[model samples]
Structures are given as C-alpha cells and as structure tokens.
Target: MKLYKVDAIVLRSREMRDADRILTLLSRQKGKIKAVAHGVNKPSSRKRGAVQPFCYSSFLLYRGRELDSVNQCEGIEAFSGLRADLDRISYASYLAELTDSASMEDQIDGEAFFLLLTILHLISRDGADVELLTRSFEIRLLDIAGLRPHLDNCVGCGVPVESETVGFSSSTGGVVCGRCSGIAGDVKFFPRGTVEILKLLLKWDLKKTERIKVPPRVRQQLRQIMQNYISYHLEKKLATALFLEKLYYHY
Candidate 1:
C-alpha cells in the first residue's frame, strides 16, 4: 500500500461498526475520496476532531486496492459557526451535498476545492449573508463542473435578450429569446431584475459577493432558477433540500 498525503475537507461522515466512520472528503490533491477513519467515534481517538463534516485537515492515508484507510490527520480549520446557527448549517449542508454530487473520483479540481474552502470561511465569519454565499458557490461550482449556464445571447435564436423579461431554458441549457421561448416546454421566464442578477453571478468572483444586496423577491427568483437549473441537469432530489425546507419554511 502506498502512503499519500492530501489536504481535504470532510464533506460528510456516517458511523460504522466498532466506533469507526466512513468519510466523504473533497481532497485538493485527489479530488473526492472515501476512506475509513477508524475509531473516530471513540472519545480517546485523536482523529475525532479532524474527521467531522466540514473540518479541513491534512490526512495521511494508506491507499489500498479498493478502499483507503486514514492513518493520521492533523486539524486545520473547523468552521464552528455552523454549529451555532441552524440557517448556516442548512446552507452548508446544501453546499456539501451539491459538491458531493457534482464531484468525481480521482479528478483533481483544485478550483472547486478552494472554492469550498473559501465559502466555508465566509460561512464561519460573523455577518456573512448565507443566501449570497450559497448562490455564489452554486454558480461557481456549476462553472467548475462545466455546467455553466449561458448568459450572453439567446441560446435559441442567437438574438441579444434586450427585453425586460427573458426565459431560461434548461433544455437549451441557457437563456432563450422571447420569440423562441414558447417552442420549448421547459422554458421559465424571469424579470429583468433576476436576469441582471444571473448575469452578475455568472461574471463575479465569489470573493466580491460580500456587499451585494438581493431583495426578497430577487432571492426567491434566483432560488427558483437555481432549483430548475439543477433539477434539469441532475434529475434527482437533493437530500439536503428537504432539511432546508423543514428549517426555513416549515415548523
């Protein structure tokens, strides 16, 4: 077995037999890896702090033929603020879920790795807007995964969308002009406000999203657009969405 080192963030973890845990990690060197961090559930285990979800750490791993084993881990950053609030946790879980679903095994996405790290840092800080961070991460991750939605001209008729309203076509995988929108069954229109937001999100870096203000109506519009865009591509329900619904809209 080859011993290798990687810097990664624990995305998710589930308890296993004998106080061990199976970790889903997004590694900087190796992309995504699942390794058994043995004995983490035990109180005396040194790996306890570093193996929890959202913990960023450097790991020494023993690479086997099929699955790897975590030999040692050194703690880096644990965003404890997520533990202090339900809303932050909800957004963090959604971010983790989206990253986990989009990532592939052994594909090194250094951009994506650092993107998650940056967002985690933003989430940990005081006065961070959860919606803004979440939306920024969503758009950036979509870009890294090569699922970037076209925000330039119309995807259908190749005309510039100069109207006050436009349609987002998941079928065309971008914006559709008003004239060609009705030709597709999956087109959804958004106002000029949401259209501008999409354009800004597509072009802005995540670090520049701090002072950006989005109204409640714009937030709702962006959420629906993101939901439709993701659902059109993934075609499956994200497990964290249910939790988010329970926390925010439901009692």
Candidate 2:
C-alpha cells in the first residue's frame, strides 16, 4: 500500500465495530476521502480528539483497495469553540453536510476547503448572527458551485433590474424583471432590500458581515429563499439543515 499525506477537515464520522471509526474527510488536495481509524474510540488512543468532527488535521493515510487507512493524524486545529456551543456546532454541521454533498471523490477544491474552514472559524469565535451566517454560506456555496442566481439584470430581458419588487427565478438563476417574469408562474417576488441584502452577503467577507443590519422579517424571508434555492439545487433536503431549523425555532 502507498502512503500519502493531506490536509483534511472531518466532515462526518461513524462508529465501527469495537474501537474503530470510519471518517468521511474533505481534503484540500483530494476532494473527499473515506478512511478507517483503528482504536480511535478507545480511551488510550492517541487519535482520540484529533478525529472529531469539524477538526482540521494533517493526516497520513495508507491507500487500500476498499478504503484508505489513517496511519496517523496530527491535530492542526480542533475548532474548539464550535464544539463549546450548541448553536455553532449545529451550524457547522449544516455547512459540512452541504460541502460533503456538493463534492465528489478525487476532485481537488482548495477554494471550497478554504471557504468552509474560514466560515467555521468565524462562527466559532465571532458572536455572529447565525441566521445571516447561514444565508451567506448558502449563497456563497451556490456561487462556488456555479449556481449563483442572476441578480444584476433580468434573466429574460438582460436589462438592469431596478424595481423595488423583484422576482427571483430559481430556474432562471436570478432576478427577472416584472415584464419578463410572467413566463415563469412559480417565480417569487422579494423586496428590493432583501435583494440588496443578498448582494451584500455575496460581496462581503465573514468579518465584515456583522456590520450589516438585517431586520428580522427580512432575514426570515432571505432564509426561506436560500433554503428553497439550496434544496432545489441539491435535489434533496439536508438532514442537518432540518435539525438546525428546529433548533432555531426551539430556542
């Protein structure tokens, strides 16, 4: 077997028989990898805390025909703050789930990996608004996936969309002017301010995001729009997303 090393973020993990764990990692050089960590669950295991979810580590893996085996993993950053808070942990799970769903094995995406790590770090340390962060992540994820909707001009007319009431076409990939929106019966109208908010999210970095004030109602609307858009693109509802939504409402 050949040995390799890569920087990875733990996307998910499942317990195996005895003290082993099967980890689904999103790697910087390799898009996604499944590896077995023997004895990780044991109290004396050296890899105990290093293999936890949301952790960024440098892993030495031995390639196998069935699945890779983790020879060694040295913790780089555990993102401890995320694990300390329930809300942050839930949000991080949602982000990880989306990344895992969007990626394929053997594909390298350093940009996406960097984005996920940066967002995770922000959520961990910054007392940022979870809803806004979630929405921003959704938009940015779509943008990275090349699924970002057209916002500057009407999807149909190619004219600049300047109306206070704008129609968003998930199918068309952006805003459509009223004149052109009639062709799509399912298109939803959004306040211009909501449109502006979405644009701000797309343009700003995670740290600058806190400066923008979004009203509760506007935030709710944006949330619905992003959730619907993401679901339509992914073609399935995310389990972690549903859990996060429930947590949001319960708290």
In order of listing, the candidates' clash counts read 0, 3
| Model 2's TM-score against the true structure | 0.94
lDDT string, candidate 2, 1-251, tens digits: 39999999999989987899999998998878999999999999999888999999999999999999999999999988888788889889999999888887778888788888888878887567766877888888788878887889998989999999999977667789989988676699999989889998987878777888988889877977787777878889999989977877542
Compute the lDDT of residue 12 as modeled in candidate 2.
Answer: 92
Q: Stretches of candidate 1 above 4 Å error?
A: 249-251
| TM-score, model 1 to reference | 0.95
Q: Which runs of model 2 end up more than 4 angstroms from their true locations?
A: none
Question: How do the predictions measure up, each by TM-score?
Answer: 0.95, 0.94
